[model samples]
Every structure is written in structure tokens, then in C-alpha cells.
Target: MNSDAPRPSPRAIASLLVLSCIVGLNTVDRNMLGLLLPQIQQEIHISDMMLGVLMGPAFMIVYSVCSLPIAWLADRTSRRGIIVCGLTFWSLVTAATGFAQNLVQLLAARIGLGMGEASNMAPASALIGDTFGGRYRVLAMAVFAAGGPVAIMICYPIIGRITAEQGWRAAYAFMGLAGLGVATLTLLIVRESRVDPAHGKAGTPVATQAASGIWRATRQVAGTPGFALLCLASVMVSVNFGAMLAWLPSFMVRLRGLDTATTGALLGTYKGLVGVAGSIAGGLIVTGLMRFDQRWLAWAPMLFCLGIIPAELMLLFADAPSWWHIGLAADTLLMSAITPCLFALLLSLLDSGLRATGVALYLLIFNLVGQSIGPLAVGMINDQLSAAWGTAALRSSLLIAPLSAAAGAALLLALAARLDTSQAAPG
Candidate 1:
């Protein structure tokens, strides 16, 4: 390698990692609530529905509504500054969550936390998309995306441990402090990417560029076949992803009789390490295969989804004891590995100009509907059936995940079939 050819600046790498940690920490905070739910509920006198509201509507709705505006700001202002301020705000809120004396206080804090978190991804994504070009962009995005899993690995277990020893409140306080530190680092390290001079501000203001309203950007994206299909596929992916994130640890404890710490470790290992490997591998593989054929966008998801079926079945019926652990592990790996390809496929659909909005929309549907609804629905099902089947009900609820996954596979396959094989990027 030509070291003299101006390698990616150390500052850039530091910024990216800090951005990654910021993302990781955010997810960690989110997942900590789930991991410590039993304790939090018992202490705070909340119901499962309240848990749903805290993790779901309180957090996601605000986050989803705000993301576009924040991304719009990123388009119009400094991506670095937006991300730094966003991180600081959320970090403080995450800490404040610990001090909540009742549901109202916690709900308000989570909402504030949601608002802060909303700013992190869109601009950070736009920044990474701008900083690295083409194939490396996919890889860099994959590395940054790994923040989800890596944060899960570190944060889940840490929360589990803290909840065991210092209590959930202490865990929340610790996470908040961690977020503050990361936000400070982001302020110092992350530099804004150079914007195209022709555009009035950060690049082109997404709203002004579209003659129509903000909905216009979404409508334009929806009109594009590949982009539309990718977004649809993303929602399906999110359903299963959400189920795993919010409930699997709980499921393991209730169904398999694992302790909270063990459940966290299991999820962190399979979902974090294995899933992250899959994400990075998916991005790199698609980039390499695209050198030969662009159809890899469709092909990767088709193949990855196909690979998950058996594992999904294993998870659905793992109570028989013979295949429980094996099935659980495989499902974990399958879900993790599939994500990188899913993201790369979505990115491939948009022109460079629309990537931020495109990514934001992808996230909007994926998070708002899939992440927000999937877990709550599953939880509702478990709660409803817990009286009839005891703890076995949670396992039954997970069946929805794989069934949705299969439907997602069908959607991606149909989309891939329609893709033009012509060797050209969209102009």
C-alpha cells in the first residue's frame, strides 16, 4: 500500500470509531432497558404495556419523526456538529433516566433520549457515505453498522452485570456517563466531510431540491423500483431483527431457564460477534461480487434469507432439547450475517444525491413499523398466552419472526427478479 498516497486520516478513523461507539452506546441504552426489564418493572411498578410504550412509541415515534428533519439539518449544516450535539443531548438524557422517580419522569427522559438519538444515525450515515466512496463506502458503512452488534455485546452484558450488583438505576447512570464521554470525543475528533460547492449548504437541501414537500422525496424514492423494493425488504428484515433485540434475551430466560447474565451473554455472543461478522462480510462480499455483476444486490439477500429458514425452524421448535442450543446459535448467526447485505442492497438503490434521505426512509419504515411494532406485538402475544401455556408462550411468539422473515425473502426474491441486469449504475 502506498502510505505516501495520503491514507484515510487518523482523525477520520478516530471519528468513525467514536461515531461507532456513539451508535453502540445508544443501542446499549435501549437494550439495557429490555435486559433489566424485570427488575425495572418490579421496582418502578410498571406493566408490560408500559415497557412497550417506553421502548416503542416513546422512543421510536419521536426518533422517526425527527430523523428526516435532523438529516435535513445535516444536509444544510455541519454533519459533525449535529452528531456531536445530538450525542451529548442523548447521553445526558440516558443518565437522567436513572434519576426518574416514576413513570412520567422515565417516559419524559426516554422521549428526550429518543430526540437525541434521532440525530445520531442519519447525519452520521451521510457523513460516512460522503467520506468514503463506492465499495469502500459499503465497507465503512458495515464497520460503522457493526456498532449495533458490538454495542449489544458490550452493553447487554454490562447491563446484566450492573443490574445484578448495582441495580438498574446504576446501570442507567453508568451508560449515561459513557455517552457523555463519547459525545465529548465526537466533538473533538469528527470533521465534517467537504460538501459539493454547487449545493447551497451541506450538499443540496433535500426539501428545496425537491419541488414538492418532504413527502416528495419519499414519493420519488418510492417510485423507483429498486429503491422501493429495497425499503420493503428492509421492513421485513427489521421485524425479525426487532424481535431478536427486544425479546430474545427474555425468551431465553423464561423458556430455557437461563439467568439474566447468561441470556445476555448468549445473545451478545451469537447476535453481536456472529451477526457483526456477517454484516461486514455481507458488505465486502457484495462489493466484490458487484465487480462482476450488480445483480448481487438481489442475489445476496435471496441467498442469505434462504440460509435462515432451517435455523428459523429450529428456533420455533427448539423446546425438544435435542436441537435447542444448536438451533438458537444458528438463528443468531443467520440474522447477524444477513444485515450487511440488506444495508448494501438499500444503498445500491439510490443515486449519491438521495442517499441520506433514502437511508433515512429505509430506517423510518424499518424502525417505526418493524422495530417499534414487532416486539410489542410479540410481547402482547406472550402476555396473552402466558396463562395458558406458562412460559412456553414466548417461544411461540418468536414464530412470527421467521414467518415474517420468509415473507421478506419472498419480497426480496421478487424484487431481484425485476432488476435489470444491464451493467450500469443509475445515472
Candidate 2:
């Protein structure tokens, strides 16, 4: 992927906005399952472990596994085409989720959704890097990345209402149909463009690396400085994110005695609205820090991870409204730093030609191990302790998320230390 057009052009800005919207749609479609878990549970009668299985392995297994090949294809082919096809396919799968009659059908639908979404982030993230280089790239990526929280802010309340009034199935159908429109818009608006190969940061040598077989590309990506440590950090941080997002509504409903509407409103304000703020702030903070030292890319996220550990713990255990609000706001803001920082560090580090593959591998480990383990661990804890302590069992179970977040912070510190002595892995 290469580009010659001025990065600040109106057309480029519009394209980025459109692409970001598409990414947000992807988030809403994927996480809608977690959002409506209570409604789904009422209809399907799933155990906590089974819920974990559905949220964790059943979806993420295919999501993480299939992304590698899709990313390889994206690296070599047309990214916009792949994104269009994927969004369309996943939207259909999301709608298909409404037709699920039992847990088996739901599982099948979720797997299909995963397979479709596997094609999403890598290509898009890589495309953004291609479009906007250097400091601007991080900010652009931050905007794109905010699609997650923005989607929640924009869609969660509506979806919650739909679930409360029309049922979870209706919410599923609504989101799926909405995604089809978004896909069509993306197909119309976003164009595939390439610039001189010389424009790439790593240039001709790296281009050859992408053309080589997958194994060599894998090694090249894996060998990039701080790449392994970044992956480790992502894996750890995603554990907390995965559990928190997946269980948030459940947690609110079961422990705080909130209904779906109330929970959605609360989350939309805190996790979604505050989260959107955090994303932009992360980009701005890192971009400014990079003026002094690129190592700040690693350092900033380490600090965020440390901040999130205690905030998440407070979110889980604090009984006072003030502490809960402070914790939730702080966690959303601090945790928001991780994705942009990680992706910015990753895209900056990798040669342009193989970005999708590198990102895919990073996501594979992050999701397959970290995200899977978090929700599963929490659900297992819930099942084991629910009888003894009831809904409060989840409060205890959620403690693991912060500890895992701490582990992520430790890895980021290691990455920063490595960057201290090395000249690589930076803007």
C-alpha cells in the first residue's frame, strides 16, 4: 500500500471518515452479542461457562485464525474490496444470528460472524497507515480506532431499546440491515490507490519480503523490534478489555440492579462517550510525546496500563457511586490508550508491504489467548461461585481482569526499556 496525494486533502479526510464509520459498524455488529447477553440468556438458557464459550472461543477461535490468511491476501491484493466483501458477509451473518433457535444455531452464527470479521481490522489499519504517515498517522489511526467506542455510544442505547421492546432478535436484525447500507457506502466512497513503491518506509527490500512466502513474512514480522513485547502487551490488555466489555452489561444488571435500558445509557455515557474522548486524547498525547522521543510510544501505553489496573479494580469492587463513576471514567480514558499506541507502534515498526500479516499475527495472539481466557475465566468463576455468593460472584471474578492488565503494563515497560537501547519501533 502506497499513496502520493497530500494527506490533508478534503477527499482524503472524507475517505478516512467513511472508513472510520465502516469500522464502527463492524464493532457494533461484533459486540452486539455481548450487549444483549441478558436477553439472549433468557431465551437460550445458557450456563455461564457456555456463555463464555460463545463469547470467547466460539467466536474468537475463528476470528483470530482466519484473519492471518485474509491479512496475507490484503497485503497482496485490494484492501478496500476485501473490506467491502467482509462487511457485507458479516452483516448477513449478524442478521442470521436472529434466526438462531438454540445454542447450537447461535454458535454457528457466531462462528460465521467471526469468519467474516476476520477480514476487517488489519486491512483497514494498514490502509490508514498507508494514507497518513508519521505523527498524523497516529492521530488518524486514533480516529479510526475510536470507531469502537463511537459505535457503542451511537448504537448501544438504540439497541438496548430494541431489545427491551422488540427482543434481542430484532436488535440483531436491525444492526445487520444497517451494516449492509454501510458496506454499500464504503464500496462507493473508498477507492484503492497506490503510490510509488519508493514511498514506503522500508522501501524495496521490504516489498520483496511481502512477496516471499508466508513463513518468511511471518518471521520478518515476528522479528521486528518490540513486536513480540507489543503482542504480549496486547494479549494481556485485551484480557481486561474483553472481560470488561463482554460482562459489563451483565455486571450492571446482576449487581447494580440496572435494567438493560439503564445499563446501556450508563455505558453509552461512560464506556462509550468517555471512551471516545480517551481515544483522541491518546493519539494527541502520544503524538506530542513523540516530538521528544519515539520511545514515548511504548512509555505512554505502559503508563496507561498501570493506571487502568487500579481503575478496573475500583470499577469491580467500589460500592460508592463516586468511586464507581471515577473508576469507570478513568478506566475508559486510560484503557483507550492501548489500541492506538499498539497499532501506531506496530505500523511504524513494520515495513509497509507486510503490515496486514504482522497486525493479523498480533491480533491472533491477543484474541486467541488473552480475550478468550478473560471471558472464560470470568464465566467459570461466576459458575463456581454464583451458588455461594449469587451475583456478587461476578464482582470477585472481575478482579482477574485488572491483574491481567497489570501484566500488560509490565510488558509495555519491558518494551520501553528495550526501545531505550534500540533505535527501532517508533514513529
The TM-score values for the models, in the order shown, are 0.89, 0.95
Mark the 10 consecutive residues where model 1 has the least summed lDDT.
1-10
- lDDT of every model, 2 decimals: 0.73, 0.83
- Tell me the tens digit of each residue's lDDT in model 1 across 1-427: 0012223567667777888888788778776777877777777997665666777777887888888767766665687888888888888888888888899998898789889988877778777755655556566677887888888877777777877888878888888888888878887788865332333455555534772356676677666567767767778878777776777777777777778777777777766787678777777787777776667767777777766777877866766866866776677666766666666566556544555666677777778888887777787787788789988888887777877788788888888788775422221
The lDDT of model 1 is: 0.73
C-alpha displacement of 370 in model 2, angstroms? Answer: 1.1
Off by over 4 Å in 2: 1-6, 194-196, 199-206, 420-427
Cα error of candidate 1 at position 259, Å: 1.9
Candidate 1 regions exceeding 4 Å error are: 1-10, 194-208, 211-216, 319-322, 421-427
lDDT of 2 by residue, 220-322 (tens): 8898877888888889998998898888889999988899988887888776788889999999998887777788888898899899988988888899979
Tell me how candidate 2 scores on lDDT. Answer: 0.83
lDDT of 1 at 142: 74
